[model samples]
Structures are given as C-alpha cells and as structure tokens.
Target: MANVTAKDAMQIHGRNPQHLVEKIIRTRIYDSRYWKEDCFALTAESLIDKAVELNYCGGIYGGNIKPTPFMCLLLKMLQIQPDKEIIVEFIKNEDYKYIRLLGSLYLRLTASSQDCYKYLEPLYDDFRCIRVKNRSGSLVRGHVDEFIDDLLHEDRVCDVILPRVQKRYILEETGEIQPRVSAIDDLLEDDEDTEKESDDELATSTRDQ
Candidate 1:
C-alpha cells in the first residue's frame, strides 16, 4: 500500500473530508417511503441488517429509481464511520454476495487505488448470478464481476459519486499491514422478520409491476 491518504483525495473533490456521509445521503434519492421514513442517522453497524436483507445487486432496481440496499448500506458505511478492517473482512467473506458488494463499495470509496486493485481485481472471476433491474423495468440476472468492472474503472458506478483513489505506498513503509480487528463478528442474522424477499417474491418492477 502506498502512503496515499483519503483526506488528500477528498480535498481534490472540494468537500470536507469528514462529511463524506452527508455526500452519500444527499447524492441518492430512493422512492421507498420506508427509506424516507427511516434511514436517517443510521450507524454503520446498524446498516448491516439492511445489507444482509439485500438479496440482489444492481445499479438500478427500476427505471429512474435509486440503487438498492447494497448501495444504501455502502452509503451508510460511509456515514457511520466504518472500520476499514471490518469492511475488508466483509469483502473476504464470500458467503453472501451483497455483503461482499458492500465491502467492495467501501474499498472503492476509501481504500487506496493500489489496495482497490489488489483486492478487487481478483473478484473479476466471481460469476455468481445475482439479480439486477434492467432499463426497460425488467428484473434480470447479472454477474458480480460485471458490476465490479464498472466500479473499478468508471468515475461513477450505480449513479454514486466516487472520489478518485490514488495509489498509497505510504503504509507499506510502516512495515505493518494493519491487523484485522473483528468489529462485526457478533452481527448474526437474528431478525427473522427482515428476511430478504425470495427470488419468486421479486417482481419485474421495483416498486410495483
């Protein structure tokens, strides 16, 4: 990892580096009244529930609609002061695509460009069939890497602004890759009521078909 810092990148964007959370929230607009009614001041830890319930991954869930829980949780991670180690752990755990998606999003937003390339490049082979919403307002199947490709290369993926991550070799000189701490080991799926919508339950329309 180079000595690249998030603050430097954030400064180039001309926004206060500390207020990245506000940027995420202000940039997105979701039609789910549930979101408007809720989703304010949610801690990064609290957003895990929503991320787990997110069964699909896509830039858009419907026509002109906002991103899904995968994106929302990523945004929330930015909001609630996430621990990079914990988020990296999420990326390594392949049990759930949405969780990994959240981790990937975190890295894209805050990790060094070198770290992003080192970690995310290999996931290009992940051919898991997750659900996505197409432009004609149809639900369809897509691969995880297909989404990752755009995220790695494009300035904005999933209609979210991403600060350019420069390479960071500074950390390497310190001779210690930060030890991974278990910040979220206790986050088990206990909320049975919040179980994700099944594939059969998912409809062609994000709101209503």
Candidate 2:
C-alpha cells in the first residue's frame, strides 16, 4: 500500500488541496474506515472524482450519499444540449434517481413535447405541486385550472383530476388493492363465533344434557 498524506492524496486526484486535506483529517478522526493512511487516500480520491462529476452536471455534494436540486437543474440544462453523449448516458442509467428528478425539472422549466408531457402526466401529478402566494405565506394551486382549461372548457381543472390519475396508475401498476386480511384478533373472533354456533347446535341436539 502506498503511504499517502492528505495533501498528496488531493494532489493525486486534482482536487482542492486545502479542502481535501481538511476533509481527510476530519474523516480520519470520525470515520474509522479512513483511519488507515492508504485507505483514507483512496477514499478521498473517490470522493473527489464523484464531486467533480457532480459539479460538471450542476449538482452539489450532500455528504457521501446524495446530491442537491442544483445538480438536478444542471443535468436538465445538459440534456437540452445536442452533443453531450455522457449526459445522455447518465440519464439512461436507472440507478441514477437524480436523472428522473432532472427530467421532472426539465419538463417544468421547458416546453416539452406533448407526447412527453402526456407520458409524464401521471408522474407529474404524483410529484409536482403548484403554489400561489397571497396575503398569507403560500397555498396549493393544484392542477385544477390547467386540467379544466385544457381538458374541459372550465376555467380551472377539476380537483379530482390528479387523484383520478394517481388511482388509475396505481391500479394499472399493482392490480386492484385487495382487502386486508384478518389479523389475530379477527381470527380469534371468528373462532369464537364458530364455537358459539357449535354450542347452539349441540343444545338443540341434546334435549336434557
């Protein structure tokens, strides 16, 4: 294993020398896995690479596991361009949940194709919200105005539209929701009922028992 200092590790990965050294020192103190000099260096390099990739796409590193909304916006911006093959590749990866988040943002920010909008309508209904500011802080506008205006001739969309869309999608995806099965209490009640019925029948059969 190569003996690596925090400064050497950051230099090797072309990261911010000062920040990387600070991060390595912090991780060495808190994260037991980074206590080893070689392991710490390798982890730092990986973090730097991941951070660079995210920055290129417009994301901010949120600890080791997640990226922020700014990153999603960046990815959306990249997707609008004609030549970014790597961005396309990243969007195609299913494991990249951020890609879906970016797509949602793109749809909202840009006028997407009608076909794309229709395809995403259900998901949008599920995830998106409209807010209006009045004298009070904020209020949900819902999709009532748009759906009614577009689908019907109404001034606002129906309140039921989103719920209906979500219900349809759930039905299509998971079949119909089955009735919940009895738990122990219900089962015990059923058993007691059966016993009562049996006792009644025995009383009827035996005249003087």
Candidate 3:
C-alpha cells in the first residue's frame, strides 16, 4: 500500500487518462424535483431499506415512471456524502445492479484517482444489464460496461458532474500516495450532535417566547 506508486496504479489499471466533455445529464438531474430531497442523515444500514422500498434497485420497464428512484438515490448520495468504505461495500455487493451502479457513480464523483481505478476498474467487466431512461424519455436497456465506460471517460454521467481528477503523481521520497481520510464515522457523530443541539435550542427559544 505505502509502497504503491502512481505508475503502479496506472499499470494495474491500464486506463490511460484522457480529457472528456461534461454531459447534459447534469441539467436533467437538477430539474427533477425528487433529486432535491434531503438524504444527508441516512446511514449505511438505513439506506438499504429505502433503496428497496423505493424500487430503486430494479429495472425500469416503461417510460412513464416519474421521479425515478435510482436517479433520486444517486442525488442523495451526493448530498449525504457516504465515505469510501460504505461506497466500496456497496460496489462489492452482488445482490442489486442499482446498488452497485450507485457505488460506481459515487466513486466516480468523489474518489481519488487511485481509489477510483482500484475499485471501479473491475466493474467494467460486470456485464449485468441495467434499464435506464434516455434523453428521449424512453426506457432503454444498458449494460454495466456502458455505464462504467461513460464514468471513466466522460466528465458527467447520469446527470452528475465528476470532479476533475489530478494526475497521479508519486513523490520519490514517499514512494506512495497518501490514502484519503475516512470521515463516515465522524460524520454520523457530528450530525447526531448537531441535530440534538438544534432541538434543544429550538425548545429553549420557544419556551422563552
């Protein structure tokens, strides 16, 4: 891990970097009312139920579905900011195509170059079919390969803007890139404390008034 270099990552991934254009999907996501829902407080354990109940992890059959759950869930991921570990866990699970797709999308949006390549490169080989809505508002069948390819090469996929990744560079002295700090545990704690404090303050103010 510490000894791994950028060259090693590239050699392992073999995905030569390229500049890509941002897709129009971003606009569509923003325009959808359901995408604006607050999902920041959801936990890894809690999200599974919501994913299932919302019918987010299944295939779309018709064009009439409004406020598509998958897109809404993807937007929720951006808002909630699940850490790398949770995202990776989602990717590793073989149960649901939509869950894995969410993981891949989250990684592309937030992971470092090395982490992205390390986790998502393997998903390119996943041939599972996922039904998606196209620009013409028609339900279409698309495979995992198509989704992963667009995420790898295009700046935006499924209406999300991916941050530009810095080229992998190795310090000759360190011999490895530093791993990103994980904040999921801390985020849960902080959010809980913040909510409690807000509730207390609201009660106190209301009593005084």
Candidate that scores best on TM-score: 1
- Using lDDT as the measure, which candidate wins? 1
Cα RMSD (angstroms) for every candidate in the order listed: 17.8, 19.0, 19.8
Model 2: lDDT of residue 80:
25
Candidate 2 Cα errors over 4 Å, as ranges: 1-92, 122-209
- Number of the candidate with higher TM-score, 1 or 2: 1
Pairs that collide, model 1: 1-168, 1-169, 2-168, 2-169, 2-170, 3-168, 3-169, 3-170, 4-168
Candidate 3 per-residue lDDT, tens place, 80-149, comes to 4555688888888888777888788767766666677668767766888877765455667889878887
In candidate 1, how many clashes are counted? 9
Task: Give candidate 1's error at residue 56 in angstroms.
Answer: 1.4
Itemize residue pairs with steric clashes in candidate 2. Answer: 58-71, 59-71, 144-157, 145-156, 145-157, 148-157
Local accuracy of candidate 1 as per-residue lDDT tens digits, 1-209: 11112332343235443344343343453344435545555655666666777877655445445556555555455545467777877788787887887688778877766678667766777879877655455677878887777777788765566777643345445643443222233243333324444433564355475
- In order of appearance, the predictions have TM-scores of 0.61, 0.23, 0.56
- The lDDT of model 2 is 0.33
User: How good is model 3 by TM-score?
Assistant: 0.56
Write down the lDDT of every candidate, Cα atoms only: 0.60, 0.33, 0.59
Residue 87's C-alpha lDDT in candidate 2?
Answer: 38
